[model samples]
Target: MTHIAVLGSTNMDLVAFVEKAPQRGETVTGREFRTIPGGKGANQAVAAARAGATVSMIGAVGNDSFGARLRSTLEHSGVETDHLRTTEGSSGTAHIVVDDHGGNAIVVIPGANGTVDHLVPGDEGLIATADALLLQLEIPLAAVLAGAQAARAHGVRTILTPAPAQPLLPELLAATDLLLPNEHEAAALTGRTDPRSAALALLERVPQVVVTLGAEGSLYATRDAEPVTVPAPRVTALDTTGAGDTFAGTLAVAITEGRPMPEALAWAAAAASLSVQRAGASESMPYRPEIEARYTS
Candidate 1:
């Protein structure tokens, strides 16, 4: 199996289902509330593991109940958490509001996630061994850069998902092997609304880029190859919280397994389509067999 190392955040997602998001200072009745083990790091690790990759995580949780649950959840999903640290402060939490249409607005309190600014001892060795290193921006930028640099040094492919989009340094973009950004994130990164133009703009920074266009599918660009579009599998979405993470994780595994880019992208899109039909973050990712079945069905 291909090995994947993920360096990012771990948060417990506190979700509330409402008919519509509340306006400023206007209280609206919600239908339900639930807590799910999430965080972009944990979600991608779980998704890759379920998609048949040997996965490991490098991140920080808190010395709180949410941290404990999050750790257990990752362990249960078959992610190696030996590098998962526990800080003295509160665990990270993502306060999310999901409306009836499956759209969501989220506010994240960094908490312990803010403390992961440096890599722990032995983390460099792990990065060297992995076939691919997955990363997100939920954690501190310094740590993400450290991991990306280490992966680049070892000739490991570094896949970066710039989520919760922020202005990134050119050095970070240069170290990335594959830059995965959703439509909104792509726009945020390039200040371009068209996905293709955004992807082209990003290619100036990284050799490869994939712009995910929610339901329309994904667009891919490489230095020499012409850009191509891969249409998403149509599915009635129940929730879209982890769909991008699912796509990223699945893409990593498929690429590591040596599948062609177009085939790998189709496989990833199928997995994400399945994920959106379900509800939670990590809980929504489908297993390899499920994805294979769906793709062939």
Candidate 2:
């Protein structure tokens, strides 16, 4: 199995299902509410494990009930959590509102995640042993940069998801092997409204780029190769949360296993399609068998 290491945040997702999300300074009633385990790092870790990768998670959780649950959730999904530290505070949390249209709006409170600004003793060793290291912006930029540099030193491929979009440091991009961003994130990063143009702009810094287009599928670009676009399997979405993470994690596994770019993007799109048809974050990701079936269909 391809071994993947994830350096990111672990959050308890508090989700509210409603007909429509509340507007600024306006209150609205929700149909239902539930707490789910998530965070970009934890979601990718679960997605990779379910897709048959040997996954390890490196991050911190708080000394709270949510922290315990977050760790348990990752372990239950087959992710090794030896480097997940329990600190003395509240775990990170994402407050999400999902509408009937399957669209979502989220607010993330860093909480204990803010404490992971640097690597602990064993983090570098764990990253060095992996075929790929997954990163996201949910954690502090310091740790994200450190992890990327460590992966670069070990010659391990680094896949970064610039989610909850922010300005990226050139040094971090220099160390990243693949930049995975959604259409919105691509726009935020490159100031280009067009996905293709945004991706091309990113290539000036990173060697490769994959900008996911939700139901339309994903686009892949590399300096040495022609860009590839893969269409997603058509499906009615129930909740779109975690769909991008599903794509990133599955794509990382597919690439690490030597699948062609087109094939890998299609496979990852299939996983994302399956995820949107379900309800929660980590709970919505598909296993390897389900992804294979969807891909072949």
Top candidate, metric lDDT? 2
Candidate 2 residues 48-135, lDDT tens each?
A: 9999999999999999999999999999999999999999999999999999999999999999899999999999999999999999
In the predicted model 1, the residue pairs found to clash are none
Runs off by more than 4 Å, candidate 2: none
Stretches of candidate 1 off by over 4 Å are none
User: Tens digit of lDDT per residue, candidate 1, span 167-277?
Assistant: 998889889999999989999999999999999999999999999998998999999988999998888888999999999999999999999998899999999999999
All models: lDDT? 0.94, 0.96
* Model 2 steric clash pairs: none
Error of 1 at 53 (Å): 0.4
Clashes of 2: 0
